[model samples]
Target: MSTRHILLGLLAMGPRHGYDLKHRHDERFPQARPLAFGQVYTTLQRLVRDGLAEVEETGSDGGPERTMYRSTDAGARELADWAGSVTPSAPFVANEIFAKVVVAILSGGDPAAYLAAQRASHMQRMRELTAVKSAKDADLTTVLSADYALTHLNADLRWMTTTADRLATLTAEVEST
Candidate 1:
């Protein structure tokens, strides 16, 4: 989940301890899974190892030493590079379902049946995500996340129907190859 870039961005703000990084991450990424302390510390150690970050200070004031970390120049460059990169609109070139359909047609199986099954699955997932989005007590972030999932599932449902309709043609094309 680009944890390295996330941590580097946080460090760019200012020096922070592992605990602070966790807190900031939680607040910033409400829709994301919570970061565990072990993960945070492990990623931080890797950042240090890679010369992307450094321990700025270590507090030992009669308590557990809190190591404050800051991003190095290299970390800033990495963050900028990630930020500038443009992901394609439809980046499902390696989609497993597409592969399955091709394989089914190649093996003389029913790609239409596979598409039907996939449509059913996508519909069920959309129903589940719709429930989450429509919950009375759901927060904005949670609702947004559910909505995003629903949109993708809806697109998949459309693709399933379209593919099923053209399965015969697809099978012919595959047979020709």
Candidate 2:
């Protein structure tokens, strides 16, 4: 995600200080992807360096002095363009267990145990996600999307298990050659 663009958009909503931006970001983050304070501040620095945000002094009496930020005209233009663009979805989906199983098999080690553990974990996660969907009072569109994502995850888990089984069998056969 373009944290810079996100920051710009947030600032465009109204003038905000770095602390306020971080607070807002933390509130908006999903449970699956939490935002860290460090990340929020780091992105703010980058935005300042890029001239996308300008610092200002607010006379509001809110305890200590706060350095407020306002999005520049250039920043607003960039934010609009970014929002309008339809970029392809990210491709690097991290499945650490799946990757580790592949590595163990390639290294001539037994991957059966790891693969089995991964299957159990993945299925458990799928069940949990399904339960969340059922237990929530979300809109129909959101529930449908969640169901689709859960199904995709389940399919990927099945594929990983099948691939691991084939690889283990093939490795055993190759060793006997």
Candidate 3:
């Protein structure tokens, strides 16, 4: 996720303090990993520097001072453009597991065993995600996120099987190198 753009999007709602932005982000996109306080401030600082956001107010309520930020006109346009732009399709093979399999074969290790173990790991995670998706009490956003993950994992399992089926050819190709 684009943290900068997300921050801008949040500011679009209204001026918000840094603390509010982090909590709001967590609530809004539960699927994403939580952001750190430092990251929040750092990104906000950069946004302010880049003319995308600005401190609209500064005040203190008997404790630490708070600075509320709002999106600049440019920030709104950039956020809208980012929201509308099509995300380029990432290469399916551009993943650690694929690289691991290739490296294991290149290093003269048994790719079959590696593939088996990796497949088992993927299946285990899929079961966990499925359980999350199946939960009746799950938040709709969380359930949808789990479903998305499960779908990708299903595709990965299919690829694992295909790669295993062609392991012999793959082994030969690696040996030739």
lDDT of 2 by residue, 1-177 (tens): 788888888898899888888777655543325557688778877777888888776665868666788898888999999999999886876677668876886897768877777788878888877776687576554467568778887887888778777977887899999
List the global CA lDDT of all models. Answer: 0.87, 0.77, 0.91
Residue 125's lDDT in candidate 1? 83
lDDT tens readout by residue for model 1, 15-89 = 999999999899767769999999999999999999999999999789988899999999899889988998667
Clashing pairs in 1: none
Which model scores highest in TM-score?
Answer: 3
TM-score of 3: 0.82
TM-score of 1: 0.68
| TM-score comparison, 1 vs 2, better candidate | 1
Better of 1 and 3 by TM-score: 3
The positional error of residue 113 in candidate 3, measured at the CA in angstroms, is: 2.4
Once superposed on the true structure, which residue ranges of model 1 sit more than 4 Å away at CA? 12-14, 23-38, 49-52, 60-63, 72-78, 88-92, 136-144, 168-177
Can you give the lDDT of residue 78 in candidate 2? 91
lDDT of 1 at 31: 66
Error of 2 at 164 (Å): 3.5
